[model samples]
Target chain A: MSSGKIVELRQVLAERFPREIPPPASLLTTGIECLDRSLEGGMRRGTITQLVAPYPSCGSASLLHDLIDSMHTSASQFVALIDGKNSFEPLGNTDLLLWIRCENANQAVRATDLIIRDGNIILSILDLKQNEVQELRKVPLTAWYRLQRVAADSGTTLLLITSHYISGSCFAAVQINNPLRINDLAELSYTVSQTRLLDFIYRKNYAELGYAQA
Target chain B: MPKPSLFAVIYTPYYRLQCAQQKRLRTESNQQADLPFADRQTELSDQYSQSYSSNSNSITHQTIPPVTVYIREDIASALLEDSQIIEINPTAEAAGVKIGITPSLAVARAPELQLYAPEVELERQQQQALLQLCYRYSPFIESTGPGVCTLDLRGRRNKNQEIWARDLLSRWRSLGFAANVGIGPNAELAAQAAKFANPYLEVVENSQLLRSLPLESLQPSAYLLEILHNWGIRTLGALIQLPREDIGQRLGLEGLSLWDRAAGRSAKVLHHLQPPEIFKETIDLEQRLETLEPLLFILRRSLEHLVLRVESVYRLVAEIKLQLHLDSGDKLERSLPIPAPTQDITILFRVLSQYLETVQTAAPVVGFTLEVFASDPAKHQFDLFYSRLKDPNRFFQTLARLAALVGNNRAGIPERLASYKPDNIRLRLPAFDWKSNSSISAESDQPRIGPALRRYRPPIPATVELADGKPICIHSNLIKGHIDKQRGPWRTSGNWWDPDGWEIQEWDIQVTDRGIYRLTFSAGNWAISGVYD
Candidate 1:
């Protein structure tokens, strides 16, 4: 195809699909240089982001701890951690954290719904990393979509931490593959800050690229 | 010079009788009086007579129109004191029953007579209700006497005081009280206006209007009235016309005081009052409250009224005490603590409705008393960047809904229990002033490492092959494989003094297929207790 015809086709596609360009100031900083730069500042507000770590010791929990600590220290915002299967253990300042420990994935999802509807906390993390696959499977697809809607309405950043990709409604998804062995707490935290995750290509990127071509 | 302060006095005539009628309406409609409903007037009269005769000792039959009603009916009636007729109704007056006459003699003169003793408690409650109602109009109010309230309208500028007075009187009349309102430059003048003014309101610039009022309106001692009658001073105008120095010399302080009052020069210092802080209202439901909607409606109305009153005093409602009087004669009282002291009607209503929706009354609601406790508005210094909940009341309401949906103990902040047992924690409701602070530093002294374990509530039962007290393999629904790496059993037990004591042997093992699992052997059963994240 000729370049002019390609450009015309791109223009038509761009007109059909639009992508949200959040204000630079509205994005919440993760306090990690590479992560923030890759996501163009940090997580988008009023959207859900998923961190998928299929293997053990993939640094997802460390990332959660870092994000919570950063939010507490920098933004002075409250963080709610809905721990599915009652797994999450606090590693840093818990004064700003409201930990809701649930018995199963169902309970955690319900807790997330309540917290998002309350619209109180700035960040809500639903940690389902240790939930059994059978228990997690019990959650309906509509529950995740409902959570996304509530997150948008409440203007809260919902970060879903799980062992595998569970929903297609996430605004952004990143897979943790970096592996590191550490003997001390300091080394573990440093490794966590240094580890890089692969971000899955979102549909928004394709729309943006189409718009740029047009 | 400061302008003379204006005052308005609300005087409810026959306050005790009105209170007795109110009590009868409140307590007797559903219980006693078999009068036909179609005859509403006679039904009300019968209810009043029945209640009045039951509470009073002077009357034995439920046929007489209580003393005040007899007076209104133009029938002979007298109020007895110490076996003498202290006051005679107008009908009795026309029938030759005079004050200070023996009751038997007064009865002889007026062959058909009715008498009623005073109800002190009922009168006191009615007075309080009057004070509470008038306090809404003006903050500086005083319960001058039984059924009398003096309101200071100093800074209030209604174009016509008569219209304001009439509106007040109408409100009192709606409550089944015959009230008269009068406005003047001073309290004494306002009271005098209420007594003798033709239209119930008399705003006098001088003592000119006081001329026609009888000396009896002043309510002087009988000796003073007798003395005034003998002196041919029957009117306030005539009394004021007398020389003040001569009256003081002749009649002493009593005569001088009366002279000053009639002349509108009385310097009586009014006890400026602070309206009582109590904000409560009770109403008998016309129909049974079988559902939550009607009860909520009434509660919202009462809450709005109380919120307005609390706002008038620059305060906020901190708590609500709801008392439901059920048809079963049982009282259900619930005290709802406000998450945040607020004047918002919607928030207060939500708090009340949330409670009422869950409350299971023993019987149909017949009456209710709602009392809201007031507090000074809470002052919060919010953080510069961190925001608390945008609306705390809304958050609390959502919390309540969530608690209702899930069990109450299931949803809230998790607090770890101080025990050696694994997975020990409890949920707690958030405080009102929950806010985030960036200055809070982490407890870095004890930094934990390794992935947190996810506990399986009621661990899955498993079959394990043992070799020298070590698990060689495990078979379970979630994990079915040979154990690759294994740890020895760790034993823990607690509560030996109680029959519900527990002893458990736990082991950390990695299955070939399942990544890692915590196996527990308790009561001769091996189960997969949890999984390592």
Candidate 2:
């Protein structure tokens, strides 16, 4: 076939069987330029974003601190932290933070559901980095989907802090691999804010693209 | 220009009879006299004797006793007192009983009569109730007489005054009183209209309606009434027809004053009053409330009535005091605080039902008194862009439900306790004025650092193997694995003077398969304190 005819045919095919273009994700700025730039523009609103840090004492804790600090300083919004394993040690003024200290993954999940349904807090961080894998495994996949639905409905930004990937329904998963280097607390905070985390977006057309001819 | 003044008079025809009947019903069930009937009789009889002896007029003069007996139902009856019949019910009147006649003579005339002694206290209470009910319509109210109240409706705009009058009378009827409401320009005219009006009447032109009423409806002295009767001036119109000068020349100032009133020209100043602020209603249930549904039904009805009263005054209900009288002679009392003062009946009913659901009564409820404390309506202006609670009342109600589901002390905003003890916290209800801006502090002094801890309610017991004074392995119901890495055994102790003093060593350990865990070595026992999720 001629190139012009092929182009027209392609255009007709595209219109008849349209590609599913997801709506543009609304972003809620983390107030850190580096993080926002790395994730296109901060975190996606109304979706779960997982921050996985496999090793102990990785800069994930510091990253969480910076996210909370940025939200507090920039938007003056309240952040709810549903601590799964009771390991997070809050430092400094936590006036804008609601700390729901849960004993295990189940309690943390329940707390997260309650806060998400309440729809009062702007950002909810479900930190399960210190919870045992066995305990986290008990949290049904349905629970994660429910959380995702609730977060979307409420337009709340849910940041899941875990040691491994748990939520299949997450919009994107970012891994914090940089270890704790700076000893000074102030320098460590600044360094954590600049560190580039790996971002993995879960696409809907992956299976379709795999079946298509290259 | 002065506002056109309108007055409404609510008159209960058989106030004493209704009060006595109510008292009898109330006592019949309890088998106890809240106020002794015999003592009331003696008091009434003594007052009658004094008034009778003091008035040394002709025998034709009629003296009204403070207490009057009337036949309410058809039953065997006898004269409880030799005193004259001051008041008689329709049944007694039909049986040939007349005022000023002795009770014995009336009983002889008709053998079947059911006489009920007057409950003076109950009548006074009912009169006060009438005043309170009328006060809801107009602020200027006066207790004109027993079960009679005059309300000034001046400056009050109503498209249909007759409908308002009928509604007032209907409310009174629901309270067990056959009341009539009348509207006029003055208190005297309104009262006269009320006495003659069939259930409800309004006097647009006072002279027109006032002319047909009997002179006795004005409640003039017996001597004046007798003089008017002698002159054949039976109706107010006939009395008003006579020349004012002639009446003054013939019967002096009293006659002129009476003529003025008959002419609807009496400038009677009403005793304007401030209604009582107490919004309480006590209801004696006919049947004991054995279930929550019935109790809630009664409570909702009472709350609706009270809310109507509150709304008339442009106020909202802030709190409710519920006192349930149990059949066992014990009382259960609860005061429910409204998180947001509201005038919505549905919201108030929800609040009341939520409270009643949690109530565990020792005995069935025999009676209840519900008093709603009203407050001035609140005014607020929210920011244009700021987020607010979708429904504050619903949120509070949901909080209550959640509390009931979990526990009283479990749900709410968590507040940290001021102590050295680890995991010291308490839950407190959110403030009524919960502004989003108030949640975050304006001052950014403390540098935010580290992740927040997720505390286990009670630390799980765990076995720990130490290598060189450091935890190397950990096993518990939640986590079982070797410690991959470990942090310090931070020692802390406090409250040494008290018996609850504590000393502990806390360690942050990262298990191999499990996540990071906080281990505490206290009193020779090791336990997993929390997870850093």
Task: Give one digit per residue, the lDDT tens place, for model 1 in B1-533.
Answer: 98668888888665654554444444332322322332534544465455435544321222322111111334566666678776555577899988889988888888997665554655664566577678767888888988899998877867578765764664454344667788888899998888655447776756567777888888888999999999999999888878999999999999899888888877767786766778887776767878877677656655655664565354678999999999999999999999878766666877888788789987999888888998876678876776677778887776776666555776566556766566566777778887543265445444445443456776899999998889998888878888877765789888878896788999888766455667899999999887654
Q: Which pairs clash in model 1?
A: none
Best by lDDT: 1
Error of model 1, residue B196, in angstroms:
8.9
TM-score per candidate: 0.71, 0.69
Q: B218, model 1: CA deviation in Å?
A: 3.9
Among incorrect, acceptable, medium and high, the docking class of model 2 is incorrect
Q: Per-residue CA lDDT of candidate 2, range B1-533, in tens?
A: 89777888988776776676654454343323323444544554464455445645332123222222222334333223337666666667776877677777877886775556766655655666577678767888887888899887887877588866765764564444667888787777888888878878878654677888888877778888998899998999999888999989988888888888888777887888887766777777768888887677656656665665565454678999999999999999899888778777677788888888788988989988888998865556875755455556775775665555445665455556777789766656665655433444433354333333345657899999988999888778878888877877799999989999999999887766455667899999999876553
lDDT of each: 0.71, 0.69
The candidate scoring highest on TM-score is: 1
Candidate 2 positional error at B112, Å: 20
Q: After superposition on all CA atoms, what RMSD does each candidate show versus the true structure? A: 11.8, 13.4
lDDT for residue A186 in candidate 2, whole number 0-100: 29
- Range of the 10 consecutive residues with the lowest summed lDDT in candidate 1 chain B: B62-71
Chain A TM-score of each model, in the order shown?
A: 0.80, 0.79
Worst-scoring 10-residue span by lDDT in model 2 chain A: A205-214
